[model samples]
Structure formats: structure tokens, C-alpha cells
Target: MSSQKMRTAQIVEYNKPYQLCERPTPVCGDNDLLIQVHAAGFCHSDLQVLHGQFPAHLPLTPSHEPAGKIVQIGAQVQGSWKVGDRVGVLNFKNSCKSCVGCRQQLRRRHRTDPRFCQSREMAGFKHDGAFAQYMLADPDTTVHLPEKVSFEQGAPLMCAGATVWGALQKLKPDVQPGEAVAIVGIGGLGQLGVQFAKAMNFRTVAIDNRDEGRKLSMEVSEKLKPDLVVDSSAPDASDKILEFTSGEGLAGIVVCTDSIQANAWSLEQLGNGGVMVPVGLPKEKWQFDSSALVFRELVIKGVYVAGTEDVQEMLKVVAEHDITSHITMLEFDDIPGIVEKYTDKAMKGRLVVKIA
Candidate 1:
């Protein structure tokens, strides 16, 4: 293949194995950076795109969590960004200034974040993403990878870390430091949620049914681990949490798994006036009794992938606190294997593909 052609693992059809093909390398647009793809991480969102649960352009390359070095900088890009800068790319791109999210006078007051604007370009879903030798990245949502963080680790942080970081941020106004915050479903995002909660000085609790998930919550981070680990499958699970908090229940809960049962179960663990943030995208409808909201005054809010500033701040925390993603590194040749293992019921940690 010529230098202009790059190998890509494309979703040529829904519910099918990825097709490896050589396609012309994407050109750097005026507002984009051409990245020499090194690592791409698979998450639940990738599985959704693969199985056609999410709308996607056909033959799209899959992987929203991508990390690499810039090989070419767009002419219109500002700042110190240049060739050879290691970076992680978020999925959202090209915000339309005319959209409701962008046109709001106050960004924080906007009902929808500009990153979720309907007209925005979404890598992996609407455009070719990192499962390739090269890909285009929007500078707006990209962050530089620290020297302490590797491409493999940075890849998953783009989604998993930023997402949990944003979810935890939502709890700050309601839950004070040293208050109890439980991280439900300790896997890729959950593991990080546990760490980030602790880093934020919340009394962190890790909850998961799988032994591996519980074990991972305590093992993933060197400096920070949950204050407690609870087996959600235990017959006395809710009671255990209540006992730990002195019958107050958790001050806040971040639901990271897509299981409707898990999400519903999390709602029962929150104290009165507590908040719950659901970051997982589940296909099944999430059902909850209205009594909890009315009687407990509980707040449940949805979070998509975090915005650009949040991602950048999340990286800073990861670097400062020595936070690390528990990653399973695989070769680009094993794209199919990556997809298969990601579907495992007990899959723990993030699966990252080395594409270089």
C-alpha cells in the first residue's frame, strides 16, 4: 500500500465482523488534526455502534476513545498544537454555532451542552474513527497526553475517565466532600468512577456483582481506591450499604453499567435528597418507581460523553493523582477478538488496541 493509504477496521455492515481494508488517509481539515493512530479503546458505546443499536454511517471505523500523536496540524488550528504532540481525541466535533446549545448566552445555563449539538460531527458514528492507521481529530475536544500516561491508558481516559469525571462533578453541588458516593457496576467506567470519587475526597464505595469487578476497584489505582467494596449480588447488599453509611444510604450514586436492573438497584441506595447520575447507555428502558423521587427528593440526571474542558481537566487529575486505567492491550489484528471479549459478561477494565 502507498503511504497515502492506511489500514482501517471498518464496520461494513451491522452485526458483522470488522473488515480490514486500505483506504486513503484522511486529510487534515482547517479545524482538524491528522493523527497517526497509536491506540484505540473499545467501550460499550463501540458495541452499540457495532450491533446497530446506535445510528451509524455504514462502513464506519469504530472506536471513540483514541490516542495518538499528531502527524499534521490543520492550517486554522491555534495554540501550541503541532506535529508529534501526543494527544487523546474525543468523539464530538465541529459544533454548529447556530444550534440551541451553541446559541445560548450562558454556557452553563444551556439546556444542552454544545458538544451534544445535533449538527456536530461524531467520530466512529458519523465519520471514520481510530481503528485505523490514521484519523482526523477535532482540536476542540482533544487533549494532550501527559508524559506519565501512555497511549494505551490515554485512549480509554478519553471516554471512560472523562465520563465518570463529569458524572462525579454533577454530584459536587449536592454531595459535599467526605460524604458517601457509591460507584455502581465496577468495570471500565466504574473502576475510574471509584477512583475519581476518592480523588474528589468523597467517601467512595465500589459496588459490583462480579468478583473481578470488586477486585479491580481496589487494584486499578495505586494511590486511590474505594473506601469500601460491596458485592451487589449479596442478599444483604442494600442493608450493607445502609449499615456503612449509618442508615443514611449513599449521598450520591453514579451508575456506570448499562444493565437496567443495576441502574434501578442503584436508585434504592441513595439517601433523601441524594443525586444519581446515569452515564451508561442501556438499550432496555430504565424503569423506577415514582415514590423514590417524590418521597426522597432524589435527583437523577443523564450524562453523555463529557465536554472538552471536562476531558482536559480529567486528564490533569489522572496525571496528578497517578490515576491509571486498568487496560487490556491487544493488537490491531485482534479487532474481532477485542469485540468478542468486550461482550463477556464479566469483562473488567478497558480493552485497548495498538494500531501502530
Candidate 2:
């Protein structure tokens, strides 16, 4: 509490190493909670922010998934939130209440969908995020971490976990219990998708390319016990998936990789009337056969980070099922190295920075 300055990892330029420096402690606003960060998870989106692929302002503190204890609370923040509470912050900091998405949320008695709102202020993009020792978060965008969940586990849930949870929820309409669902890419997000698919009573199929990814997918398959694991590196990977499902094909496919080829190939595995949810951000545009979609009656949808309600529900599901993230913890000074590893596709699973 006596510290007047805090350490922050900031992006001074595009595709550059984060500059760790000392800055004045952030001031808490009327509706903000001053958090002392315990753990901040490294997300693929963070890499996008660093490479300037995503829309981010310069000289930004880049990290959206954070879990910590509330050191100070704003006077205007009501409800049961208070100092000393363990909490996780979401990427969407705040949304304009007058927007159509916000009004829809109000009518449904749910949290706002900031991604759809035009006046949304996102953490690590529009505002300073949790890559610092001390950062401010809007109380409405914060979720309480249960006693059963550790800070390391809670941190990645903000973005990575919540994203797949939201995507699975969106695909629920097309997916039926006992039917197979394919999760492309076995990295941070795909792993979570595998767990959620199994927990939701769907027979999960994990798909990844050859080499290290295949090995990682096999390991995850053994640990999580998915119904089937498919290596898309094979020429007949889609045929293998169809064979696994007994020619019914997958009820829905969730594409979690940024590879344009993987995204395009995943569509071939979807059954008639099946939906394909693309969650990863690929730099280049994807090309697919238009006749295939028209004849198969396929549905293609894009999903962003979750709304607050989805995060809350996802937390409950995670706790109930005892779902945990595969994370590698690193010290604060290792931020630069971690970014480099992520860019090179050398890092496995999610990486969490131990800030406190």
C-alpha cells in the first residue's frame, strides 16, 4: 500500500519487445477497482497486439487476462464488491448503455455484449490492461474468483476460457448430446474447447496438424480423454473424422487455429446443417467452396470474447467440473522472452506471468 510507483510492461512500438518501466500508480475512478495483479495470462491476441495485427493504440500495456486481489475499491461501486476480494477482470471494460447491444442486455437482465457495442472500451486496447503491477478495472467487468480456484487458473479464464465457452454456447443449438464436435488446434483455446465439449455431453474430437501440435494434442487427448484425436496433417483427416462419427460427420466444428488452411479444411468435416465457429484471428482471408456451403446447408459464424453472463456461467461450469488450464508460470522480467517464444510457436499451453 505504501508503494507510489508500479512496474509495467508496455509496447512502445509494433513487433518490439515490451519495455519494462516504473510508472506512477494508477488512480481508481468512481466505478473502478484498483487491483494488485497476482497473475496475468499470455494470450495469442497479445501477440496480435504486439505485431499490430489487432487494432490497438501505441504505447499500451498489453494483457487482457488477469486475476488478482482488490487492493482498493471506488466509492461509487456498489454491490458486494470490496477491498481484499479475489477477482478476475474481463477484456471488455465498459460499454455505452445507450447502444442496442447494451439495451438488449438490459432487457434480458444480463451483462452487456461490449464487442457488439460501438462505444466499447476494451482493456489492453483502448485502456491500460493488467500487464502492470497495479491496474484499474470496472467493477461490472470483474468476476469473483471462488476459493477453490487459484489465481493462475482464474487469470486465463478471462479471455481464453471464456472465448471457447462462448463459442460452444453459440454452437449448442446445432450440436446434440452424444453427437461428435470437432475442435481444431490443440493450443490454449482448443484445449479448453475439448474440455467444455466433453462436459457438455458431446463426444469431442480434437484435430491438429502434424509435428509438435500432434504430440500436444495426443497428450491432451490422454489427459482429457477426448473421444477421438485427428491429425489434420493427413490427406484424409476429414474422412477419418467422418469415420469416427460413423459417416454422420461432426455436428459442429470449432476452429481455434489462426491457420487459413485449417479453417478452410474444417468446413469439410461439418455435417449437413452443421455450424462452424471460427474463434481464431487469421491474418489472411480464407477461401472456401460456395457450392459446398449451399448444398450442405452449412452455417459459418464468428465469435469474439464472451459477455459477462457467459463468463459467470463459464466460471460455474469450470468450478463444477474442476477444469484447469495447462499453464507455465514465469517471472515478471520474462515477459520479453515469453512474447518471443509465442511468436515462434515454441511455447506450449498458456503462459501465466506471476506479477505478485
Highest TM-score: give the candidate number.
1
What residue pairs are clashing in model 2?
none
Instruction: Report the number of clashing residue pairs per model.
Output: 0, 0
Misplaced by over 4 Å in model 2 are 1-3, 55-57, 100-111, 218-223
Q: Give per-residue lDDT, candidate 2, residue 147.
A: 79
For model 1, what is the error of residue 210's alpha carbon versus the real structure, in angstroms, after optimal superposition? Answer: 1.5
lDDT of 1 by residue, 83-141 (tens): 99999999888777677666761365553444757688888877788999998887877
Candidate maximizing lDDT: 1
Clashing pairs in 1: none
lDDT of 2: 0.84
Candidate 2 Cα deviation (angstroms), residue 291: 1.7
Tens digits of per-residue lDDT for model 2 on 60-162? 8989999999999888888898789999999886678888888887778765666667787788865678889998887778889987889999999999999
